[model samples]
Target: MNLSTEVRRLRDMDWGELDIKESGGWPFLLQLICCVLVLGLTLAGTYWYLAAPKLEELGQARTEEARLIRDYQSKAAQAAHLEVMREEMAILEERMNTLRDMLPTGAEVPSLIDNISEAAISNQLSIEFIRLRSPVSQEFYVEQPFDIRVRGGYHRIAEFLANVASLPRIVTQHDLTLEPMEDAGGEQLQLSMLARTYSYRQSGEEEEAP
Candidate 1:
């Protein structure tokens, strides 16, 4: 049919006159309109089903991009202070090494005890006894306690303790007791002390310890 006649016929069609069972006998333009409407609806439904997952995926991609941007900003800020962090780490390492040196290893225990005797002799104090007690094990080191007895003037004993404190290795004096020696005309005093020194435990020695 011509365009104008088709348009007029579509506009003049009566909905009440149409029957579902008689759609085959409907007007030519009306049948064509029905086919177009059904096709359009089918295409729309198919598009929605196909595109929904992709739309959800796009939203997830945007969320992932935002999270990555936040992480980059945080790491960039840390990188800006990287040199300062490295310097702090170096200082901590140096401090750890110094502490390690201050704590003597097990092999140096006898030499350390000899040094204590030498300290007392240097102070002109007569060493009565410098006894080593059994080593007490701890989490990281062993405590080597000493039972020390010496005879000297009060000032000499003070000088001896000061020299002990000035030793390169760490040694701590504890539980000091003093009594007058009557045989020396009360001019000498007997100083009894408990001293402690620490030694570093060797690695893997813990399992081998009896």
Candidate 2:
């Protein structure tokens, strides 16, 4: 049988017909693409408006917390070091007080003169002139010094100065003088010196405060 006659017979025999057409298919596909684009744009806009700022804020907060933690640690270390220094200072103060308590107090000039005389006698030297000057202010201490002249042989004068240097308190000699005695033997010489001494007071004792 012919194809059209067979199709007609099939339609008349209570069977359905299939109709195929190409019209308006492009419009339907265009509508579908538009829907997909709209959906993608909506999702991107939601993310930009709602989630991006929160993520940025979370990152900034984390950085701030880390900086605060580091600052706290540094301050804690500084406080600890300060405490240790305070303890060390207390110990030093105690030691200084003990030393000050043990030191002697008397007229410094008489003792120094007697010591000088003893050194001269032991070394077989004669003291010609000894002059002492009042102290000058040098910070918290005094710069009490003596200018001395003596006549003796070279070895004896050296022995006398050495004995003077051996005293317990600190002494420094300056402006040394040595010359041959004109009338005496060539071995005899004159010795002149400026000798210095120091004195100290206890901590917390002050001549002036501001």
Candidate 3:
């Protein structure tokens, strides 16, 4: 048997008579085709088992790396503004201190009446009476209000009000009234007004708020 005889036998082979169970007795071409098909299936199964998981892990690693890069960029941007943020916080604290200083303390609130009295006396006005009212509760601070009555000329009353405005602590006048003193002189009048000041709430006072 030579290569041509083999080729002639292959060409004359009957396709309908082939049996997979009798592979050993099959023609050379059929056996070779069967071996190639088996080799291809084995390689495909090996790749699925060995390489597919590694490829999936590589894809996950790339995704994690991208997420980490984005996180680092965001933090670096925040870090660049850190000094400016600190400076702004310091300025805000200083402003808050200045405002707190403008508000009086609980013990010092009583002396505020003396301040108003001094202002009236210095302005040549007779202090009729200065009385303290109940303290008012608010969300952030306590408001201390007082009532003041004085008798004086119009210019002296105006000067007393201006002096009250220039006090070290904050004060405001409200509900002002003036009337003639009835024959002491036409120039003499009585002035009545409510004045208010503020104070900072002490620690542990928030629980008492209603």
lDDT of each: 0.89, 0.74, 0.88
| TM-score winner between candidates 2 and 3 | 3
Q: Cα-based RMSD of the predictions, in order?
A: 6.8, 13.1, 6.8
**Residue by residue across 1-210, what tens digits does model 2's lDDT show?**
365754554445421332225323324443455689999999999989998999899999999999999999999898979989899999999998675543323356568777888889889888887787776545655567778899999999988888888776566899998999988967799998898776664456554321
Q: Alpha carbon lDDT of residue 202, candidate 2?
A: 42
Best by TM-score: 1
Number of clashing residue pairs, candidate 3: 0
Q: Give the Cα error of residue 39 in candidate 3, in Å.
A: 26
Q: Which of 1 and 3 is the better model by TM-score? A: 1
Candidate 3: residue pairs that collide: none
Steric clashes per prediction: 0, 0, 0
- Among these predicted structures, which one has the highest lDDT? 1
Residue-level lDDT tens digits of model 3 in 1-210: 376866777789888887778878776776777899999999999889988999999999999999999999999998999999899999999999998998998788777778888899998999989988888888688988889999999999999999999898989999999999987777799999999999888766862332
